[model samples]
Target chain A: MTALARALITLAVPVLLVLLAVLAVPADGPTCLGIGLRIWALFACAPATSAWLWWRQRAVPA
Target chain B: MIAAFVAVMALSLLIALWARRGAGQGPRAFFVAGGQLGAILFFFLSVGETYSIATMLGFPGGVYAGGEGFVVWFFGYILLAAPVLAVLGPWIWRAGNLYGAVTIPDFFAAHFNSRLLERVIALGAIALLVPIGTMQFAGIRLVLGALAPGLPMPLLLAGAGLVVMAYVALAGLRAAAFVAVLKDALMLGAILLVGALALLHWPIATTPVATATMAAQVPVTLPFALSTIAVQALGFAMIPQNWAFLFAARGPQAIVRAQAAAPLYMVMFPLLMAVAVFARRMGLPVDKPDFVFLAAAQHLLPGWALGVVMAAVVLAGMVILSSVCLAIAPLLTRNVLPGLDGRAQQRWAQGVTALFIALSAAGAMAQVPLLAMLNTVFYFGIVQTLPGFLAALWTGRVRAGGVLAGMAVAALAIIGVRLAGISAGGINPGLIGLILNSVVLTLVTLMFPRRDGHSVMAMLR
Candidate 1:
């Protein structure tokens, strides 16, 4: 993959996850559930993506 | 409360003095802790600087005023920022190490070999950051005045300024780092204690989990929240002070480790917002929404615990203020006024820190907007530099001319939109400016591509 493509993916993946989390929030259900989903996306999913990217970068020879 | 404040301030000063012990006398040590900060110290410093009075006071106040929506997006954005930092931080550190760069402009100067570009960036940084320092002072005054009404406001502001300036001048980033450990501890303790009390004393629910949903009283549109999260997270990583911290790391790996662990510290925010939501339910009488955290603490905890909470809040403000003052002073002395000798530059930085702190204190005395609003304006200005910085990192296409033009265009757009009160479908002005900044940067770079491959690109490899 090109560097530009890789950069785009790196930026897009977290944003996509956040967007999906926001979309999954029910309009009228328990607010705690919505809050939980948002927190999971930020604290869990986002960091996981970052760690994955870091690992990938490390795996590649400089 | 008074005794707790005094004790906390004394302890902070002692920590600052201790941090000053091994710090060598030089610009690098003063500005970047000699680029020798270990993982733990770097973690403390990064987290401490990022989560400031805004986290403790402004965040809770936002929840209190606007409901869970205000804080939920912030959480998302901050979490997202960590990963970006994790990826880019090491590269920045590498560049800094390669060039012996201390400030953001130092990186630009060495990379592009353009002192003119360095001075422009420095001037922009100083112009943008002085208001932010003033905002910190305003936040400190609010926290102190809410907790200890008996203390004189002017004296409190002056003292706060003096203490922070002394520590920053004496130990620089080391002082901010060491003091951050104490600030984070107190801040975490205070947040947990208040959150637990709020959960326990929740009148509406039989269990703590049931009360979590009660905080989502106000409805937030999905578009606004998502856009906010996107822009804010990006802006957070781009802030010049944050960049300085990246440079101060022992290595790229330390930054990644620190970024990974920083999220754990942020768990306190959701709990704090829950407390704020609970306070709103109880109809806590607060004239300002930012006072929700303090008001709830006063109502729920005993005087001693409230004192601890106040100390945490106040110290968070001071640590951030000190770090910011340290960050900008070097930009002023080293880049903006490059005529000074090494020793003279250090002296000038110290003097500038004190002067800036005093000026910020005086500004804080005048009535300003809420913490969150001031923060928005600050981020709007700072994030304009993002396109250029990213272009520098990713591609060798962009030049100093393109960067300067992008910045000028973005600044004008931000000011024009803000002054005219133009709303782009509820999108943040900063995001708008950043979009324009990227466009201008790309167009200009494509128009005037560099023939020579910069050495900075080789450093990145």
Candidate 2:
């Protein structure tokens, strides 16, 4: 994949996840599901961003 | 319990001593492990730092008090910090290597070629960092005092201070990193044990309302949480010890690789939140909200396990305390008081470390209200340097004068907004100041760009 492709996906996924989380929580206001979804979104960024980073720089020597 | 605690504590000392094998005699080896930490050691050191005493104690305490409102910002900041570090981490590593920078000020001084800028940055960092030391002690006082209620506060502080100082004296950053390998392990075990117990002993027929109430569910302040997370995540890259950690990596890839995995470490947050909620549900006798984690652990774990858990908490504070001292001391010895030979620098580093610990301990014991105020300004102050640092790396627009002026204005703006108590509609004061700082730095740089300088970006291109 191109650097631009990687960068765009890297940037978009987290933003969309966060936006979905924000809308759900405030719209629902305060539910356990809302809270869980919110936290899960934040946690999801770990793998999303990390995988992208690893893919982009996999061959770069440490 | 006391025996387990003592055993772990003693083991840490031995680990520090063991790290002294073939220790070099200079500020370089003493401060940055001679700039030779591989991905694994760097991972331990960096990941261990992100989970400081604040994370162990203050995080649960926050959840216990403010619930999801607190966790959002706290967790979000840390979660976002990984990506921030992943992107910026390699650049910082390259800068450190390119400039042979040990301290943040060392980077500025070399990049800007201005000793005065170095001193100014060092002074501001120490002001920001000293209170951080006090924060550790503040948490330490609570944890240690709870363990031995009869122990004198002064004596307790002195003993903790001595152990922290010894880490620096024994092997400097290497000792901290080496010990961090074990410290992080114990910390994870403690959290898992407490979290699992919270789940296993969880009331089987609890209602959603009760769970919500226990979690202290409130209207999440999205604006404040988002702003705070943004400034703090960006500023984490600029923090003094973080920069030191970046420099400690053997290479750019080492730093990036470790940071890419850092956010996974905070997976314990849900567990922390569970522990906090369990404390509330069980009505544990928590004298302070911050003690909720300890309270839960104490109630759930057996005596020996509790001791091991408490020992991990202590190391959490002490290792961070030692790391802060290690960061600040060199800012004084190497950057502020330059021209010291390697041996002299090492000696001065030790002395400065001791002094910072003592002064912080004293402030904590005295319970100086001013220190509390400084604590509020700590992040605000540290984040002011961000404009200067970013300018140093990617652009030639920021001259020494521009960076210096930007920081001065930003610091004043942060302090002023804070003193005036304008909530700015719940936005963090640091964010406001960072904006003004960036504006001034850019405006000034535009007014007076240097023709002779090229950024690392330009050179690479």
Candidate 3:
């Protein structure tokens, strides 16, 4: 993939994860699991996305 | 409590004096700590500035009044913003180093070759920052008044402002950096202790279970939560004070390490949110939502513990207030009055710092709005600059004229919408302004593309 494409993908992953969590998690009812899922996705996705972007930038020639 | 307050303030002053030692004299030392901060100092400084009185007082108060839904979006935005920072912060640091930029507008002016744009941005930043400083002033008053019932509010406000100005004017960013170490340690300890005590005293249910059930009952809609998180996360990333901290890093690598470690520090928020919920369950009488954290401490903890927590909260306010003042000083000395010599600029910065603090203290005394509302106004205004900043950072296609035009339109739109008191279907005004700003920017850029041969990122590299 091109560098721009890689950067776009890197940005998209976190936003996509957050959107999924926001939409899938019910506002009412047994939300312990839902809240946990949202929090976990955020915690996991941010660092994961950062690492991916960093590695991609390194792998590609500037 | 008063004795504890006196000791903390004395120690903070000594730390400021120590930070001043060996630091050379000039705008560079005062504004950017002579660019000597290492990874650990950078980490503490960035986290310390990021989690201010807002985190300690305003946040739990939000959770207390609004319920667990507040925590969801609050942490959501904060968590999501970090990765973006991890990517962009290093670039900002590089640009600042390359251009010898002390403020956000300095970077913009140097990159765009437009002194006019720099002045406009500086004016916009000052306008936004003063209200934020006012919010911090109000927060200090709230925590102090709750902790010491007999103390005079105006006297406390003036004293807090003076102390903050003294450290910031004496040692500049170093004062904030060193004080941050103590503030963060005290803040974290106090938060954990409060959380644990609240849980112990009012063990109604497991934390998750209680918070989840509270989340269900609150009126926070999904749309509101999602939009709030999106706009606030972007705003947080682009706030001027945060950008200054980014520029102060020793190198891009230091910023990366700091960004990676920041979320770990935010684990305190959830613990504090639990404390707020516990306060609610325990039938605490909180007239003002912002008092929830202090109220919990007052009602639940021992006198000595309450004193320590009060000191921590006060330190949080002072450290951030000092940083905000320092952030604004550069805009005045460097951008607004660009004709001054180095010595004159430093002198004028100190003068401007004192004047700005006085204005904010006066606004805080008026107390026309609540603390959180003042903060929201700041966020709404600052994020309007993001389109301009991103264009400058990422592309050569967008011109300075286009960016400024977009920002102007967005600012007017924000003011109009806010004044109308329209919610726009649960969307935040900042997000709306950002969307409109980007659209205008794209249209204007297509009409008047930059003739520069290289992208800003490439040129900087």
Candidate 4:
């Protein structure tokens, strides 16, 4: 991956995770299923981001 | 419960003996565990740190006592510090592999070419690590006191102390690693089972009510809760002791995978958050906020299940922390002290580690709040190193003088401010030191003439 691409992806992954966490926990509220869903979302991002990064980096010389 | 305690300690002793049988003797055996950890063991070891009694107890209490602000900082700032490891761990491993440096202070000496700096860092780390060591003693006693409240506190602490010292002295980091696997598993299983059962008695919808009821019960806002997650995340991945395990990772790729896999540990936080929230919603008295995890399990689950969960939480507290302190004290002794040959140094390292633990245990028994004291020291000491280490890797021109100078200034500021009882708002004073350290490093590097790359690398050694 190009330098810019790697940097952006690296930055975005954490930001996305943090944003999802904020949205997951209720604001002035409690949501049981929402909490579970938010955690699931956080977990899903890891494999998804890893795959995307891996596939993108494949074009570079190994 | 007593039987369960005996079983866990017996199993730990057996593992310690097994690990020692093939393990090399002295500091190499004690400090790095022969530096042969693979991805699987490394993963558990790293995650076991994430599952400290602080997280199991202190974090949820923050969420319970404070409101959403604690939640945001708790979970959010963790992501702030992880990218640091992505860069720092690889270089540390490579350098350690090249130089055969087993401890962070050794790495400091190698990187800065200064024995004095290495000693300072080691001293800072030991002072910082005292809180963690104290917490371990307190955590084990808390567990013992609960399981058998009739047992005298000193006797309970002594019993746990004997177990911790025995395993650490006999087996070293391998014992900690072996126990980490069981600790994390026990923690995971117990929290999940208890969380699920807690939901049965106290619906998730009523969590806020529970939280509100418990809030009125606290004497003050939890002292260290607000910035803990950030402080923890930043320092957690960076501590010379824990990060030494990064050196033991099989290679750069294993380090990357461990870094990548680290976020998964974040999922457990919410489970802990749920328990604290549910317990509060149920109007449970969290007089000792540290006991919230155990209290939740006892209140929510069946007798047998509670027994199992309590044993797990207590064991997790004892084994994982003992492992960390075991490595930390020895690392301090070996790297900080100068003019010693390898063989002699190794023996001295073991002696120092034992002394460090003994002092820490004594402090905890004197009624110092272990969790708070440990966090304050750890956050201050480890965060200062972040800039020096990070700049050395990512920025080629970062002078050794600049890094050293920044660390000195930052250390002074933090110590000075702390002695004055002035905090830097919610952010840790250590982090403030880190900022100064980074700025000085960047500015100094930009201003100064670049040294020859070969000489710089040589100086780094």
* Better lDDT candidate (2, 3): 2
lDDT of 1: 0.76
- Enumerate residue pairs that collide in model 2: none
Residue B278 of model 2, lDDT score? 73
Candidate 3 residue lDDT tens string, A37-61:
4444444554564555455344332
Candidate 1, B1-461: lDDT as tens digits: 77877888899999999998888767788788888888898999886744678788777776666644665576677767776776667767777888888888888887777888899888878877878888888888887787667979999888888899878866889998999999988888888888888888775732232343334333445556667676777777766778778877878778877776665566676677778777777777776777888888989988877887888888888888888888888888878888898778778887888888887888788865544566677777777777877788777767888888888898899889889988778777778788888999899989998776454555556
- Native interface contacts kept by each candidate, as a fraction: 0.12, 0.32, 0.08, 0.12
Each candidate's lDDT (Cα)? 0.76, 0.78, 0.75, 0.64
**Chain B TM-score, one value per candidate, order as shown:** 0.93, 0.94, 0.93, 0.86
Q: What is the lDDT of residue B97 in candidate 3?
A: 78
Chain B in candidate 1 has what TM-score? 0.93
Two-way DockQ contest, 2 vs 4, winner = 2
TM-score of chain A of each: 0.55, 0.44, 0.52, 0.49
- Report i-RMS for every model: 4.2, 3.2, 4.8, 4.3
After superposition, candidate 1 runs with Cα above 4 Å error: A1-11, A32-62, B205-222
Kindly report the docking quality category of candidate 3: acceptable
Sort the candidates on TM-score, descending order: 2, 1, 3, 4
lDDT (Cα, tens digit) per residue for candidate 2, span B1-461: 88998899999999999999967766778788888887788999987756788889988887776745567777777766776677677777787877788888888888888889999999889888888888888888888887888989999999999999888888999999988988899989989988888888986443332333344323347777777777877788888998888888888778767866776677787788788767776766776677889999888888888889888988988998988988988898888898988678778777888888998898788776644346446878888888887777678657899988888888788778878888798888889889999999999999999777778656545
Question: In candidate 2 chain B, where is summed lDDT lowest over 10 consecutive residues?
Answer: B209-218
Task: Please identify model 2 stretches exceeding 4 Å from their true place.
Answer: A1-16, A23-36, A59-61, B204-220, B342-344, B368-376
Instruction: For model 3 chain B, give the 10-residue run with minimal summed lDDT.
Output: B208-217
RMSD for each of the candidates: 3.8, 3.3, 3.8, 4.3
Q: What is the TM-score of chain B in candidate 2?
A: 0.94
What is the lDDT, from 0 to 100, of the residue B340 in candidate 3?
Answer: 93
Evaluated on CA atoms against the true complex, candidate 2 attains a DockQ of 0.39
